[model samples]
Target: MNRYERTRVLVGGDPGVAQAIAAEIEEICEVEVLDAPREELVMVKVRESARNSLFYLGEALMCSCRVRIADAMGFGYVLGSKRNAAYNLALIDAAFSSGEEFERMPKWEERIEKEAKRQRDKRAKNRALIERTRVDFSTMDGDA
Candidate 1:
């Protein structure tokens, strides 16, 4: 998976997956904390559908961190003040950046892919449930 997809899965899925992978990498390689986990505000931008224009929705609290594994640099950011999660995310990113070291972590990618699929299945199920509850107001309306 690409970085965006990988990050999304890591952030939304099981936190233990990221922690375990990071711990394994730390034991096998040298990890330098370039930037420790810290909280910050990032502007949320959205498009105004009616006007077809963009605007800032508001600022959202976020946690971010940076680290270096071997020679590759990695960064991670997540909504809210999840310091440990952000740190672990950065470590995982660094592992992926190094390429060769990431290969040594057996089944990590498979685990991530599986989590992504689970999320998709969950969303589909929720959508189906919501669809069943949808009311057909148009059909009940009288001709005027």
Candidate 2:
């Protein structure tokens, strides 16, 4: 993925990963918050598996904020009611989008990739655990 994509993935990813990025960036760069974190309701949509149709799952509460670093503007939107986390995301986004050179940024890319992998692994493990306990009753129809 490109730099901006990577940055977004890191910023929009798991809270721990986002926090790490925000914490590290704060030590090296200056950030100015353009918008305070605020919550809003947004419609959540889903595709019906049985039919090619879309439906609204319901309104999701989301947090959003904007930040500025140098001349670049960055924005962040996330699911749930985390004000501090939303602001952190905005700051991290702005720092990366600033286009200014930072020596530690390359290292950050590696960290982001690692964090993503970790989350994927965790999710896979959880899925496997859930599937294992899901009994397939159809397989026992003949016995009954």
Per TM-score, the best of the predicted structures is 1
Per-model clash counts, in order, read 0, 0
Give the per-residue lDDT of model 1 (tens digit) for 7-40: 9999998898888877888888798999999999
Badly placed stretches (over 4 Å) of model 2 are 2-14, 48-51, 130-144
Candidate 2, residues 1-144, lDDT tens digits: the string is: 565666566655677777877888888777787888999999999999999899999999999999888898878787889887888778767877888878887877787788778767888999999999999987886855
Segments in model 1 whose C-alpha atoms lie over 4 Å from true places = 101-103, 137-144
Superposed by TM-score, candidate 1 places the C-alpha of residue 95 at a distance from the truth, in angstroms, of 0.8
State each model's CA lDDT, in order.
Answer: 0.89, 0.80
**Could you tell me which residue pairs clash in candidate 2?**
none
